[model samples]
Target: MAEVLFYHLTESRLEEALPDLLEKCLARGWRVVVQTSDPERRDALDHHLWTYRDDSFLPHGTDADSSGALQPILLTAEGAQDANDPQVRFLVDGAEPAGDLSRYVRAIYMFDGHDPERLAGARRRWTIDKAAGHDLAYWQQSEDRRWVRKG
Candidate 1:
């Protein structure tokens, strides 16, 4: 079964939390696809990954870039599941899976706790994924800024 993880963000914002997650994925030799709901978010994430830290870098590209499959990380507004043939997929900014998600080794949903709509959406996804028989997990940041599995 595919592994599905939900990250409920309360303290750190997306810009602060995502790069660290992506970095861990990279360390494991996993190519990643980050999906957002709009072009603006897609663009913003692409740029953020580049300048997130002066000492570090996450090599990534968007659909506008050439060689989509060659990128270690890809950002997109669409739900193109296999565009980059990534082992890891991230759903950001309320983006949902478009089709079959079993192809991915792991799929992560990052939602803000302050946004009720996003929280509700995460609950819906949790229910659906649980019923679908995927391995599900929930994570929340502790006061020390460490991610602890909640469910």
Candidate 2:
């Protein structure tokens, strides 16, 4: 079964949290696709990733970029995805799960816990995914800013 993980963001914002998660995926030799809610968010994230840290860099490109298939990590908004045939997918900004989950080794949903709509959406997805029989895990950040599995 495909594995699905839910990330509840209460202590940190997306811009502060995403790059670190993407780095972990890269370290595992897994190609990644980060799907945001809209083109603006995707573009914004594209810029953020480039300048997130002075000492570090994430090798990523958007779907519109040349040689998108060659990028280890790809950024795309809703309706565009998997340009590099990634093994892992990250859904942020209220983006929903893919129809065919089996294609991915793992799928993650990261939502802002402080947003009522996002929290409700996460609950909805949790119910749907659980009913669909995909292996699901929940993660929430601890007081020390470390992710701890909640379920």
Candidate 3:
């Protein structure tokens, strides 16, 4: 089974949660692919957080146009459709349509707070309808982390 781990941000700020998430993914040896609606924030993360095996940080958005030590492909939703190369695994962080989740074999749908209705709605639209031959895990963070198998 494909493992999907959703991380629901409890803190109002995303900065507080980023470090832990990055550390966890690195420790697990997972190559992360982040999709965000905010291009500036996404560029910031690409600039600061991501590191290649060469120990060089990836460059910001369009600056990564060239293939080099600093160029990690920062794909938007449209770019993601053509990204069929098996060399990378994705860690999408945005909403459904923005993430272009159909490309991924497995996905973790992360959400904040106590809103099962919202979760259910997403399930009905995405996982139940679009995601076939894939496993999706729904996770929420509150007093502690909890997850349930969705699709």
The worst-scoring run of ten residues by lDDT in candidate 1 lies at: 76-85
lDDT of 1 at 82: 54
- Using lDDT, rank the candidates from best to worst: 1, 2, 3
What's each prediction's clash count?
A: 0, 0, 1
TM-score of 1: 0.97
Pairs that clash in candidate 1: none
Regions more than 4 Å wrong, model 3: 47-93, 97-106, 114-121, 124-126, 129-131, 144-151
Candidate 3 vs. true structure, TM-score: 0.52
RMSD of candidates 1 onward, in order: 0.9, 1.1, 5.9
The Cα error of candidate 2 at residue 14, in Å, is 0.8
1 or 2, which is superior by lDDT? 1
Using lDDT as the measure, the top candidate is 1
Q: What are the models' TM-scores? A: 0.97, 0.96, 0.52
The lDDT values for all models are: 0.90, 0.90, 0.44
Better of 2 and 3 by TM-score: 2
Model 3 Cα lDDT, one tens digit per residue, 1-151: 3444555545433444544554555456444444454556566656555543345333323323453223233333333432323222333344454334445444444444345754454455445434544444555454543333332
